[model samples]
Target: MPTYAIGDLQGCYLELRALLDRLAFDPQVDRLWFVGDLVNRGPDSLKVLRFVHDLGEAALVVLGNHDLHLLALAAGNSRHAKKSTLEAVLRAPDRDELLHWLRHRPLLHHDPERNFTLIHAGLPPQWDLAEAQVRAGELEAVLRGTDYQDFLRDLYGNQPDRWSPDLTGLKRLRFITNCLTRLRFCKPDGTLALTEKGSLENHTVGLVPWFRAAGRKTRSDRIIFGHWSTLGYRQEDNVWAIDSGCLWGGALTAIRLDATSLIPIQLNCKGYLAPGQD
Candidate 1:
């Protein structure tokens, strides 16, 4: 009955298998929580997607930025950026099923019993747990509906970096997607800095990591997220940044949900493709 939350697979299926094997994962009883980035920028995106998609009730995954990009690309709204590593997934025999399953996944999930919230990226400073869940549900409905491809087609771009409840149509949907999957740092006034994916020290003067926002309003529960591999693993009062660059020749990381302390499981991520590299 143990549950483990793993960070950014990024299509590192070998490492994912090694780590899970080390944990002796039992699909019959054990539950796995994935922080997302299940594919792209790593070897074996197809294998990873199929493995998780087959896990069914044994696993729960939130949608990461790369995951959304794959969906958008499949919808003919995005183009492969030359160095993209998702070719395998895109060309897989079950590509349709894989992409369809990804688009239907939620942006956020909260476990009241564990007092943990799982998201691909950190929550906006202004959103509490309840607000995040409600907002995620709103976007989830849009993603799972018949108009999903419509939303995916117009999903890129980072203008209107601020959150406004009255924002309508694609702009509104993109805003939510940015916050849930692509967010990293934000201005003091809570404007997302979508282009600034560098280290914390290199951020612009007014930019602050979303999780480090002063007096952040979203402190109701601990948030576990993956996306900023540069930030690696960080634990604060109630936020966990668990993406430790496993696809970058680094080790994969996982945490036990019921334990008070962090228990990490490492694997040899050799020959993996990470961000910023071919």
Candidate 2:
């Protein structure tokens, strides 16, 4: 009856396995909630994807930015960025199934019983719990429907940096996707600054992390998210930023829902990626 929420994997399968073992995770009894980014970067992307897929209902995963990138790449909508590392997943025999599963995973998940909200990235400072669910559903429908490819094709870029219900077409979809997956810092006006992916110290003036927006609105429920590797494991009563960059020589982190404590397992990511990178 234990439930654990884990941070990004990013193809670090050995670390994931070790973390699970540290928790003594029993698929028959415990549930694992993954913050996503299950592939890319480190190594063994294929193994990580396959193992998670095999876990089935034992695991709940929200799509991360990297996970969506894999789907888009599979659909021929994306290309590898510099320092990209997803070849093993792309070449896996089960690539199609893995990608399909990833594409269908929800953009946002809420558990009322636990009073917890899960997403790959944090919610916008403006959205309340209801708005988040409603908007998430809109994008979810598009992602799971015939027009999914169209959504993926227009899923990049930083235009229309602000959220507007009236924003239409690809611009609209891309904005939503970014907010849910890759968002970090934003202007006081709620416009996203997507290009600034550096640590907190590297942030520019007039731009604050999305979670710190003043006079902002989002669910009062606890939100758990990954994607910001620099933030590491942070908890502030109702907010959790658990991505510790295990693929980058950090530790894999997990939190128990019943108790507000976190369990961290270190990784020897040496030689997992290019030398000196991790």
Candidate 3:
């Protein structure tokens, strides 16, 4: 069975449907891996969520920052100043069931058989594959546990910009969440520059894309991620980035994960949001 890993959906349901048509995807035989951000920032977030949820076992998803934000909003943790485009989903009749399903999604997915790992964003340099999995599990437990609402309420922060083995409590969880779903650039010493959202060349001096940070422990692992649409599709240093800015009038990209060499297929999108709009 062929498995195709797709970039962030970001509520672009029409483009997602068109991309699937282009791939001639057969849910019965082929598998799909979605690099999260399945909702918010575009039209039809409700439809997008329902469609992916209906896919059942055919789809695999890792939670993105936007997805977590949706969960937080649903839980009444509306501390964000900017309004989100998730009202449709929040008002749906099956909202509780949908949110339940979303909350249970993993922070990281690793398939040893395929020798590939999937995440919504980049991993910290200090975490090798084993450590990454452990940290993901720790955060996942909190997200799915009874105290999830408390965690959600305290989840928004940029502190503890670096990782440490001694880190504990909410700070530790926040750092793990940021690295897995919101990270882009980091200093050579692995301190996150979470505010930088520009293209590779436009990054601040001494800051490098997370995968390029010196002594990155996951350098030898085959990793697939989304969440950096500005960085777009990249396949350098054993990392595969498929988020081709589908929400920004760029292409919606998918790469065949079953192939030895990455084969990308993209559909030009009729964008819902222009650059600089979000």
Candidate 4:
């Protein structure tokens, strides 16, 4: 009955398995909550996708930016994507099945009973759990809907860098997608710094990490998120930052969600892509 929350797996399938084994993970009973980036940037995107997709109900995955990029590329929206490891996945016999399952994954997964919310990235300071859940649902509906191709076509952007209750249409969905999957630092007033990819020690001035925003609505809530591998595995201000740069020769981290105390278990990764390689 144990449950664990794992960090980004940017196609590090071997590392994922090693970490799982280190956790003594039992698929027959224990469950896994993935922070996403299940594919791309490493040597095993197709294998990673298939392994997680085959897990069925035993695994819960939130969509990450890389995951969405893979989807967009598959949707024919990637007219200019850079060199990517996702080619293996796209050429696989089960490509459609893998992509479909990935497409259906949510941007946010909240377990009300456990009072723990899982997101692939940061949340804007303006959104409380309720608001975040609603916005997440809206985006999820679009991604899982029939017109998803259209949404994918227009998904890449950093516009409308602020949240407004009146936002609608593509901008609204895109904003939601960004916060839930790509956010890192943002202003006090919830102005997003989507391009800020540096670690906390080197982030630009005037903006704070979303989890550190003084006015953050979900500050009192427990959040488990990845995406900022540079941020490493940190637990502070009631948020867990677990993407410990597994794809960059760091570690694949995991926390026991059902534990009485927070303890991170990690598996060292053999250096894959170097920094800035992606």
lDDT of 4 at 155: 83
Q: For each candidate in turn, give its C-alpha RMSD to the true structure in angstroms.
A: 1.7, 2.2, 0.9, 1.0
lDDT of 4 by residue, 12-130 (tens): 99999988888787889999999989987888989888999989999999999999999999888775478667888888999998889999998899998998999999899888999
Instruction: Give the per-residue lDDT of model 3 (tens digit) for 1-278.
Output: 98999999999999999989988989999899999999999898999999999999999999999999999998788887366999889889999999999999999999999999999999989999999999999999999999999999888999889999899999999999999999999998999999988889787888899999999999999999999988889899899999999999998999998887797899998888888777
The positional error of residue 6 in candidate 4, measured at the CA in angstroms, is 0.5
Best by TM-score: 3
Estimate candidate 2's alpha-carbon lDDT, on a 0 to 1 scale: 0.81
Candidate 3 has an lDDT of 0.93
Selected candidate, larger lDDT, 1 vs 4: 4
- Clash counts per candidate, in order, are 0, 0, 0, 0
Model 1 alpha-carbon drift over 4 Å, by segment? 274-278
Q: Give the Cα lDDT of each candidate.
A: 0.84, 0.81, 0.93, 0.90
The TM-score of candidate 2 is 0.92
Candidate 1, 1-278: lDDT as tens digits: 68999999988888899999999999999999999889887778899999999999999999998888888887787555565677777788888888888888889988888878899987677777777888889889998999888888888898779888888888878888899999999988888899888877776788999988876787657889989888888888778888888988767888888876776666656646545664
| Alpha-carbon deviation at 174 in model 2, angstroms | 0.9
**Residue 237 C-alpha lDDT in model 1:** 77
Using TM-score, rank the candidates from best to worst: 3, 4, 1, 2
Worst 10 residues of 4 by lDDT: 77-86
